[model samples]
Target: MEHKNTPIYNAHSYHTKVPPQGIAPCILHYTDPGDLILDPFCGSGMTGVAALMCAHPPAEALHLVHDARLGPRYAILNDLSPAATHIT
Candidate 1:
C-alpha cells in the first residue's frame, strides 16, 4: 500500500514508529474479524491502530477482503517502554 502521512501517524514521535496504514493491510490479510493480534514490541501501538482500522475500516479501505468478516478484530499491544504503551 502507498504510504500516506496521516494525522494519527504524525501525532507522536517514536524511534521505531510505523504508520497504521502500512500495518493495516497486513492485519487484514492474515486475520479474520474477531481474531486477536499480539504485538510484543508494539512501538507507538500502530498495530493496535491497524487492528481498529480493520474492524472499522475507512471508506478507502473497504476493498480489503477481510471486511467480509462482519466484525472487529482485537489487538494486544505491549512495549518494553512505558512511554510507548502510553502512546497507544
Candidate 2:
C-alpha cells in the first residue's frame, strides 16, 4: 500500500498525498464504471489517478479488485491550496 517510490507518488511533492495504488483498491470496490468521485482535499490528484487506474488495472492489481467493473470512473478534485490544485 505504500507508494513512496512509485512514479506517480514521486512525480510531485505534496504533504497530503495519498498514493494512487493504495486508493485504487477502495475505488474499485466501492464504485462501478462511469461513477463520479469527488475529492475535496485532493493533493497531487492521487484519487483521480486511482479512479483512472481502475479502468485498466495492472496484472498485479487484478487480484485485489473484487468487482468486475473494469472501466473508467470520472473524478472531480479540489484543494484549498492553489499549488495543490495546479498540481492536480
Candidate 3:
C-alpha cells in the first residue's frame, strides 16, 4: 500500500507549535537536498524535524537551526524560556 502524508499530532507540548506533518512538505519543496533552515524562534522544532526527514541521514546532509531545546541538532535554536526550548 502507498503511504500518505505525515499525520498531524501533538508532537510537543506547546501552545502554538506547528506540527511536523504540516511543515515537512513545505521544507522539502522549498529547499534543495542540502540547505540551511534557521528558525530563530523555533518553538517545538517541528521545522527541524521536517528538515531532518527531508535530508534523511548522515546528519551532515541538511541543516536546521536545531537548538538542543528542539529534538534535532543541525542548527542553532533559540526560545524565550527553558520551557519553550525544552519542549522543542
Specify the highest-TM-score model's number: 2
Q: Which portions of model 2 miss their true places by more than 4 Å?
A: none
Q: After superposing candidate 3 on the true structure, give the runs of residues whose Cα lies further than 4 Å from its correct spot.
A: 1-11, 56-74
Least lDDT summed over 10 consecutive residues: which range in candidate 2?
59-68
Clashing residue pairs found in predicted model 3 = 64-75, 65-75, 66-75, 67-77, 69-88, 70-88
lDDT, candidate 2, 12-76, per-residue tens: 89876788877887888889989999999897899999899988976556778755578899999
The 10-residue segment of model 1 with minimum total lDDT is 62-71
Q: TM-score each candidate.
A: 0.79, 0.88, 0.60
Tens digit of lDDT per residue, candidate 3, span 1-88? 1122334335446666665645655665465555678888887776777666664422322243232122232455677778878865
Q: After superposition, how far is residue 46 of candidate 1 from its true place, in Å?
A: 0.4
Question: Whole-model Cα lDDT per candidate?
Answer: 0.77, 0.84, 0.56
At residue 81, give the lDDT of candidate 1: 89
lDDT of 1 by residue, 27-82 (tens): 77778888999999998888888898886666445565544454578999888988
lDDT of 2 at 63: 78
